[model samples]
Target: MIHNPNNILTAGKPLEEATKVMVMVHGRGGSARDMLSLSTYINDKDFAFVAPEASQHTWYPYSFLQPLQQNEPYLSSALNVLEMLRARLQSDFNLKPSQIYWLGFSQGACLTLEFLARNPMRYGGIFGLSGGLIGPEGTSRDYAGSFEQTPVFLGCSDTDAHIPKGRVLETEAVYQRMGADVTAKLYPGFPHTINEDELKIVNSLISGQ
Candidate 1:
């Protein structure tokens, strides 16, 4: 496994006694610090946020729409980082999978979404902004396991140059099939960026019982 230290940023409370843990992933060409800033908007004094930095500021070399093998070891390594973090959090903090939330933007969003799909579990929640699953146009998505009714929110622009609307729809369908309570919104004419509506939806989903 890669030995890069995660540039984790924390908010709310310390992990030792936090009520919830949010794992935030930044997009390509973005740093952990960029994603960490979102914690200010998602001010939940009882929740702890952790953002992991990708090696060399990129998760993978090629586009997410490329053939599965084209992204190879890098993609696998990225997934391993998340899995390792999850295991560490659970073992060290006594936190259950259901209390861990995953959020990412753009390329990071694609990585997080794909990771959750491949390893379906009852997470605190999932928020993918302007991203979708990885693979070529006709790649099969036969992911197994169930989310156990975990809430997943996906917000993207209908005309996003990086993320296609069809893929967003497909991602929602796959998660729903896995029993996730998914809320997918496609903003019309919006740029490849997160909007207030998306943030509001995420805040509402995370700040609940």
Candidate 2:
């Protein structure tokens, strides 16, 4: 198992009869509480929010731009943490895969997106803020399985110093190939941070019809 410890931050209805659950992931140097704070803007009492912190405020040791293996045991371990959370949510609250959401920012966003791609399922939705799939310049992305029509939102700056626009497009393509309903937005002159517009869209996604 990955050696990193997890700090889980929870909010809302405590998983009891909640229609939706959002697993928020923080960026490097940020805590789970930092991500969970986003729930305040969402403010949906019926939906539960959970954020799991990385052992050292960072999921992996190297840039996600490196080769998959180069990120080391941390990458695999981070994925394992998500898997464990999913299993617990399923057994404890009888939550269907379709009722769970994955949300992340920056490095956390990269991790969440890669995890969903590797373990494709019918999640309620996926919100990736300032991030894309992990890999070097020409990493092969031969993933399988459909998202079963899950909605995926990819919001990023056109000139994000940390993330390349090409990778964002590639990530969108991968999700589309997996049968996901994808909505991608590239903000002009935005920085390497989440913006209000992105939060507005996220709110709409979680409060679907």
- Angstrom error of the Cα, residue 178, model 2: value is 0.4
Give candidate 2 regions above 4 Å deviation: 1-6
Name the weakest run of 10 consecutive residues (lDDT summed) in model 2: 1-10
What lDDT does the true structure give each of the candidates?
A: 0.90, 0.89
Query: Using Cα atoms with residue i matched to residue i, what is each candidate's TM-score against the true structure?
Result: 0.96, 0.96
What does candidate 1's lDDT look like per residue over 15-47, in tens digits? 998978999999999988889888888846678
Per-residue lDDT value at 57 in model 1: 88
Error of 2 at 196 (Å): 0.6
Model 2: per-residue Cα lDDT over 24-58, one tens digit each? 99999998888888888885677899888898788
Model 1: CA > 4 A from native: 2-7
